[model samples]
Target: MQNPSPTGISKTVIWLMSIISGLVVANNYYNQPLLGLISKDLNVTESAAGKISVLTQLGYAFGLLMIVPLGDKFLRKKLILIDLILVTLSLLWMTFATELWMLYATSLLIGATSVIPQLFVPITAELSSETQKSANIGLVVSGLLMGILLSRFVGGIVGEMWGWRSMYGIAAALMLLIWFIVYKMLPEIQPNFKGTYFELMNSVIKLAKTQPVLQLSSFRGAMGFGSLCALFTTLVFHIERPPFEAGASVAGSFGLAGAVGALAAAKVGGLQKKMSINRIILYSILILISSWGFSYFAGDTYWGLIVGVILIDLGVQSNHIMNQTNYFLLKTNAVNRLNTVYMVSYFIGGSLGTYLASVAWKYAEWKGVCVVGLSMGLAALLAHILFADKIYKKQLNQ
Candidate 1:
């Protein structure tokens, strides 16, 4: 493949990327709100059903590690198209999944192939000028965040009215439509790395060892995401109990509150011009701590959960964009590999968070889940403070 010169990314192209990203990433979260329905339908316990979320995230982590780095070695458009086809097929299988194991299998495949958004994010950064890069990433990430939120809301409504299986059917169709659109609209970006596949994968580790900024950013993002995941993964159980006794739709509607945070992502990205990345990270961590406080006290109430969701999403998304902005600045030729390292850690954290939530829900319920989230946030804050100066010194020396 011939290397192409950098072209100015148009607003229309950004919007299209954002939409496709949103649609593709939505597959990972659709099972969140509908855990209850799936549990009942499959005649499985809540604990077992929660594995669907955990396994999906684990698969995504694996995918990020194993597949996303290929973008630097092959044409991204071709890779994305192939991944979408696999995602659509996975969703189709999910629609017919009658056994718990079957759904679990499909969930893993869906999560693995749904990493198209990660590929697109690096491409967006590559296409934009330095002046516009952060803002463009923010816009695309905003769409990705919206998809995470709206998938729950739409999944809840669709699952409530028709059935959980029907939601997968719809998702499969949407993925197919997006596959075609992306095929038609997306231009080919040539590979930047000419190394063998093994060499490209090895470079991920080399970059991680060399780049302290990448290490710190990946750690912080993972911790924050883990905290966020702990809350969303187990929220359904709390909402379905006692005072709330709400259905999936009501639980999923909380995404609306989080949607506010999604809208703020672009603005947060724009803050890069005025704020240092460390400062932004510190503020985001503080907001996450505060959100967990709200979540802890909210119990089964809607208002507290809503407020907490807004704060958590805002904190996570802002911190995430800042981290990516820093990562992109570290290397021009290795954006995709950097993304692979960062996102693999991120989804690993997410998987851990979901697992922690599941265990907490089983042993201690909502209070335990909140404690887990708060601890993760505090850990992120501590890591940032401890490593920020050291990493800065390293960067200066380099």
Candidate 2:
């Protein structure tokens, strides 16, 4: 009889990948909570400062498209190391920015290089055993989620204590530290594709047209992410005004609470084994909608904001993990390409969310933002229901 397949993972390797990838991914969120302080330091208006978020996300989307595909054609370890170096340089440049434009430029570079986490997660999926793939993806993604949830608070605390610029300096140092660890611990895995770069690029682009699963997953992921982004974009504003009157430091502290949900996704990695991915997606979307509804009451007290953020983070991370797990199972050779498509849509939706949040703030304040979020949440649910059964069957067969 043939022997059962092996998963090829060591606990230490998984832990290291999770930690390294998590810290690197935190680069994406470094600016979220600190936007207010950074704007003040740079003497820019809130709307003007908002452009940094947009540019940074755009840069990331660009990298996910233009650079992440290198993973399928080149050695990921080397690619990640080079990316981290660029990120470190960008952060250092940010420390000395004398004008808003300089900061915006550096922010874009930082975002572009932050694709290291993206590279790491897909590689983890490729290496994991089929039986353990979901849990493994959850473990690695938990790091990414933690980075997102915690970076805001860290940015806030560091900005408050030292200065906004100092936060970048510290993040740069962390990047260097992460670089050293990745170089030391990560095993070298060469690419499978020897095709020309153009061929690989064309192949990835073709995925959008050729793969129904890819199309559906990317759209669902985008709508869910977009809705989540819409709610989070206004959270900074809500905590800063009126009934709350909280400072940036206090707003940052709320990020600490969001980390609870992130860690919970990791802790419940076992659930992926029992719960159908469709059910998880459906449940998570409901939680997000409920959270947005509750956030309408956030004006009553800061605790309302706190509870709402917690639920929102939990729902977003859980659904994201399931969505990603399904995608990674599609075709190993296509991981980077698939990720590029999904992330581009995801970032585009997130940018729209931020813009809508700013517009909402002008018209309906927190309530308007909540309405946008709730509407998007329901749309995401509908999108998922339309395709959940098909996706489930595809993943099961894989």
Candidate 3:
């Protein structure tokens, strides 16, 4: 049997994984633009529709904590295949759901199984040469990020023309094709854990408590992601009302505006090589907070939203790549565990942002949502000022 190593990992395999990661991670966001349609179809209020997103984030968080560590203990290839199948089922469930509770159930299931992309990320890291590792990881991560940035756009257009249920139906069919590609293209990894399953879980907890770099990175990443979640979750609701009175497709156009920034930030590995990671993260938080200023000043103008979307995507994507790379490079032997901790915090922040943004949208409209995004940005800035430098240096010395 061939031992697991970086050799023989072709560019074909890398691109395949990158594309799959993008397509799969989009499951979490497709509902954002569909919320209004779902609300009317299911006879639920806007607030109730908002809970679907919150539950999906919660489910994704739960899966990261519980399922990702298994990557270190089992074959990652098998895990990815299984998750793809499960997500397909969840998508169909969403397509045919008649009650609010059924929609909630399918939302959670899709979020949990859509964690397929996280499994692929570590494999790409393992398969790259030392010199090219950063670029390779960035390629795959950018695919995932683009899927996130673009899902709302696609969902909005599909929902506007074919109805929201059609979007899920289409995703379900695409997933069946994705399953075949992964079975043919993915490579196997030998298990590295030498303990019982219970011990494996314990080690993840211990690592969370012990790793200071992981702590700092997770905190800052969460805050930035929370702000991003706040904007998109409430965006369709804002754009579809008031002077605009536009449809879902128009609301989702922001995702494209956001993607322009995401595409630029895709070259983030170069940015890290030039500047200190701490300074990059600091600048990122400042950018997120400042983007909100445009949202504040532009008022009822679409130009403000367009500028804000670009800057928010730039800042948050930069913050995320920095944080993920920071903890990811810390422990080669336990990459999955490290990812588990980082991602769990990341999604919890998203869940909180979605919940709070929904509340802000419900009570105070656009202004309230802006306050939440700016508040998270300020908190991220404070996290960088207080702990980022000191903990980074302390980890370096040891």
Candidate 4:
């Protein structure tokens, strides 16, 4: 049965939504901080460790295409609950994997099931009025961003104390708790589209080709995510070696600093009211460039690295929020399809970042990783500046 709309979005619902979104999204990142530990324990190399990041992202892309669209065609509450249960089992399975292949398979499953948060974000946006959309998006995005940043930190600590296996166990238990809360609090949201899965999938593909904003946002988001991924992927490797020999916990602490950057974007809801999104992207690009430049000299001390992470994430998160907000403003009816296009590209870029980080680390170490990050930031900046006027006109007309 469809649940009645509340007098307003309840605080209970908002709190539950944030927690559920944060934890579900955290699934994609559990393998990151543990990459080092998993490599050593599994008797694998850094290159092999890259698969965890790549496969998880590939799995997320697959889910975005095949799973997220279901939100537009089915009851969101049921889908969220089912996926949560599946993810719980997947995390539990991850804890039991003794072989690399086993871990890879479980990671893929976890990613596939973690699309629940994406489903929720779209639902929240759909539920809110235009006046409240930006704030609503920000609140939910805070959850998504927190999950991305905090997973590594939590995973690192859990991995250090109870071992890598324990980290998955912790995730599984948390999933169950989230499931209980969601079941109790979340309302059923009927699908907006009553089309067959195949028809919906076709529409998604069509949007990818026909929608310029989706294409552009996807491209820009992917590059930004790729750069971000490269920096993080290599960071684990860097901290585990050389002058600043640090453990998993120390490596994880950097995520907290990254979280600070995401928090800075809380003001984005306000900024969007006054400025054009193109202006937002332009400013974000400038910040990204400066952040990467900081990384060049920030290598020697943890504090310097913290500052670099903060700036870089601040740039990445604000631009992402702006891109998403702009894309959704396209055809309100096209939100899911546009999001599918945007996120598929975003994850693809993330996969590439993971792969390149491992490869670059092999040849040039931390310096190579930084170069990759810096180049991506610079290229994205130039491309956006070159095309800014056109993209802005296109979006405004849409």
The CA lDDT of each predicted structure is: 0.90, 0.79, 0.86, 0.82
Per-residue C-alpha lDDT of model 4 across residues 1-398, encoded as one tens digit per residue: 22435434555566567777888898899778889999999899988977888899989988887888888888777887888889899999999999999988988988888888777667666776677777778788888888899998998898989898998888899988988777877888767787888889899888888777677777778888888998888788889898888888888878899999988875687887688778888798788778877787877778778988999898888878877877777655756667777888888888887888788889999888888888888877877877768866765686
Query: Backbone clashes per model, in order?
Result: 0, 0, 0, 0
lDDT of 4 at 275: 81
Return model 2's CA RMSD, one decimal. 3.3
Model 4: clashing residue pairs?
none
What's the CA error at residue 71 for candidate 4, in Å?
Answer: 0.5
Model 1 ranges with Cα > 4 A deviation: 1-7
Model 1, 231-296: lDDT tens digits are 999988899998899999988998888999878865887666787878888998899899998998
Q: Looking at model 2, which ten-residue stretch has the lowest summed lDDT?
A: 1-10
Model 3 scores worst on lDDT over the 10 consecutive residues at: 1-10
* Candidate 2 residue lDDT tens string, 1-398: 11122556666777787787778767767677778887788777777777777778788888888899899899988998998899999989988888888988987888888888788777777777887777877888887777777888887788888888898888899999988888887877779889999999999889878777677777767776777777665677777887777767787777788888777766555776677667877888888778886788754587787788888888877777877876776765778888888888878877777778778877888888888888878888888888778766775686
- Tens digits of per-residue lDDT, candidate 3, 1-398, equal 22335453567777787788889988899999989888888888989998999999999998898888899999988888888889999999999988899989999999988888788777767666766667777778888988997889999999999999999998999899999988877778887898988999999999989988898888888989999999999888888788788888988878999998788777877877788878888887888898999887784789999999999999998888878777777756888888889899999999999988999988898899999999999988998899987987787788
Winning candidate number (TM-score): 1
TM-score order of candidates, top first: 1, 3, 4, 2
RMSD per model, one decimal = 1.8, 3.3, 1.8, 1.8
Highest lDDT: give the candidate number. Answer: 1
Candidate 3 ranges with C-alpha deviation above 4 Å: 1-9
Q: Rank the models by lDDT, top first.
A: 1, 3, 4, 2
Q: What lDDT, from 0 to 1, does candidate 3 have?
A: 0.86
Please report how far candidate 4 places residue 183 from its true position, in Å: 1.4
TM-score of each: 0.97, 0.94, 0.97, 0.96
